[model samples]
Target: MERMKEDQDQIYYHSGADLESVKDSPFLEKLIKKGYEVLYLTQAIDENMITQLLDYEGTKFMSISKDNFKFGEKDQKEEKEKNKALKKMYKPLTKFLKKKLGDKVSKVRLSNRLSDTVCVLASDQYGYSARMEIIMRAQAFADPDSFGYMTPKSKIMELNAHHPITKEMLRLVESGEDDERAAELGHLVYDTALVASGYVMRDSDYKSYADRMYKWIGESVGVDPSAPIVEEYPEEEKADSEEEKSDGDANLKEASSSSADPASEDHSEDSSEDHDELLYRSRTRVEDEVFMATVSVF
Candidate 1:
């Protein structure tokens, strides 16, 4: 029964309602970006059948999340030289992150897959994908050393050399006397990469990252880092309460005056009259906005 359950769990698959839904999916994004047609296994039994059959004719099956999956031709000499120079330039930062991240990451390398993204977490060819690892960890029967015989241990962090943030990181390491800030940046980058790769860290680590981010943001915007963490906390709450109380009369006046504005009234009437249409428009607008944001970032 346990073996049957495990096999059933392994026989997983996914299907998109339409091509556009998974058009720029992370699993297929790089391939699509480089112009490749992927055969997506949509049926639940497809993965099981493929595993049993091993291959179709001369073609072998591959996982997109694995490091060995290649899309196009190898990098030429010129491209290789360019990448070598970038690796050389970012060596300091990479070494620093490797030491700081320690056992969390297996290795760090310059990313060839990313075009505009700053960083990505990739598993070694023989290791499980980050998503699969997370699922395993969440299982009731999970063991910390479940795959004890695996040669590869942790995920690899791939940093894009072309991104401005990556360049800034390189600069920070090169600049002397900024070791504190640089270390903080390294932790931030690693945490960001971990989350992006669909893994979660310890709660304490998350809290520490948040505190460091607050300090860095404060320093960036000219806030005094030496200031007390909670200077007059209750007093601050009292002042906020006072302000909220004071706004009540002004809000009432604004509400009274808003009745005289025909445009506001028309808008409110239209919103109330066609609630379903308004909700649909709002949902679509939000979806489009989110898609545009993803495009801009990824």
Candidate 2:
């Protein structure tokens, strides 16, 4: 608090896992760049402590991760006008993002906190910060149902209107030629901001994010992401199939030749003639016996 400038009525701070994490936070980028001194709150209980303390001396304690944070600059009116203009210019893009993101975010708007970052997630003035949410989730035994009941509200997604990605996204949204692609990019950006802001994503959301990433990787490498995976055969397999077919043909030809052989036909004819001769001899014997019997009786 002693480090705060004379004109600054608010003491700014941001909470994170550690000093390194808070030091490189996107929320602190503009504050640090604008020559403001921000306190780093790294402990798990720091935010709770601040909630109780509220202020130091005559200054109020402000969390930079909240949407209500201000820079307390002298030319604030000029900045507000500038942001108002930007919001008007990017109204279509913000609407597109809100529609694409659906209920995941409470609102989409231009960011006054971002300088180097493209986007960030900011909580409501009375809502929980990402750090607080993490601590609560940890204490809630990782139960999502309990967490939902504890905090049912969604955070606001703030985009840097000056960023190149945001500019391109606005162009895509306005042109209407790449709605699908723009929606994909918007969801990706929202997911990134969620993680960057230290919020945990649901399993389904994480799966969708992973799928989009894989699709992007495939496209970047010139592969079709939607194509089906097929099994491929080698030259050896084709050669084996050809060999099997030839073996079958050879076996059929061998059987045909065996059935058409002259030796086999002659053997069959000889067996039939021998059987017919034996039958004729037996009949002649029976007829001679009958003739003898008849002569004796006469």
Candidate 3:
């Protein structure tokens, strides 16, 4: 009741047949500046009145009644008039979300509204309004079970006519959406709406969309999707490998010293030791001579 009042944005100190019976609503003027298709949902916003507003903006009425939407009459008529090749040529993403989120939905269907990217609207405008529940539950004096019985109603997946994702999704789905990308996209749109409407998305366990998104990031960085984790070759093990390598280098040095050839390039194994001894004696003599020369000069 309070929700209906707030939603109506009513004028005070009067009795009227409907909420919009306000002789001159200030809100309506502002809304018109934005050219919003505000359905003048006064007290008379019933089935017949809503039906009359269907072509208000040629469909921006927002008073889509269940009677008008009944049993595929108008939908069938619209579908027949539309290009058979085009709709089939492009995929409707809303259709995917409804199928995935079955029980918590009224129905998921394509929208003709080119305005909003997405909006959470009534499945049956007269049956259960998401806004009504919000308004009723918000009241200081309101019943609990009245709103408790209601859940997030029909999610109206409105695609932005100019959004790249919407365009790509159409091309991709029409081409074939059997791959994970399509699934991820469908999941993203649904999740965006859930978050937008301040509702908790409850399908985390069923689908790891986060994990999939992370893997996509990993792939972008030239990394493998299931790459093995690198274990730090334990600190102790790393020290041992370094020690072994150093010991091997020491051994090679010792071998080279012993295997030197005196008669070959520089020295050979046959007389390398003798050559080293002679070179040592020469160096010693040179050092002694330099020392003596220094002393004489002093």
TM-score, every prediction: 0.60, 0.75, 0.41
User: Candidate 1, 179: how far from true, in Å?
Assistant: 1.6
lDDT (C-alpha, whole model) for all candidates? 0.66, 0.87, 0.49
Candidate 2, which segments miss by more than 4 Å at Cα?
A: 73-75, 140-150, 231-298
Question: For candidate 3, what is the lDDT?
Answer: 0.49
Best model number under lDDT: 2
lDDT of 1 at 52: 64
Per-residue CA lDDT of candidate 3, range 38-120, in tens?
A: 44444422433444554432323333322123112343445445535444544465565466656555565444433344433
Per-residue CA lDDT of model 1 for 1-298, tens digit only, reads 1322221212212223235533433455444455444555543345446546755554466555567654433332344667887888889989987887788688888876677567877767666555455545666877767754432456688888888888888888888568777778877887887776555566667788888778878889999776977855688899989899889978988888987789988998888879988888999999999999999998
Best by TM-score: 2
The backbone clash count of each candidate, in order, is: 0, 0, 7
Worst 10 residues of 2 by lDDT: 144-153
Across 123-152, the per-residue lDDT of candidate 2 in tens digits comes to 878878889888988884577676575454
Question: Over 4 Å off in model 1, which ranges?
Answer: 1-30, 39-54, 74-81, 147-153, 224-226, 230-298
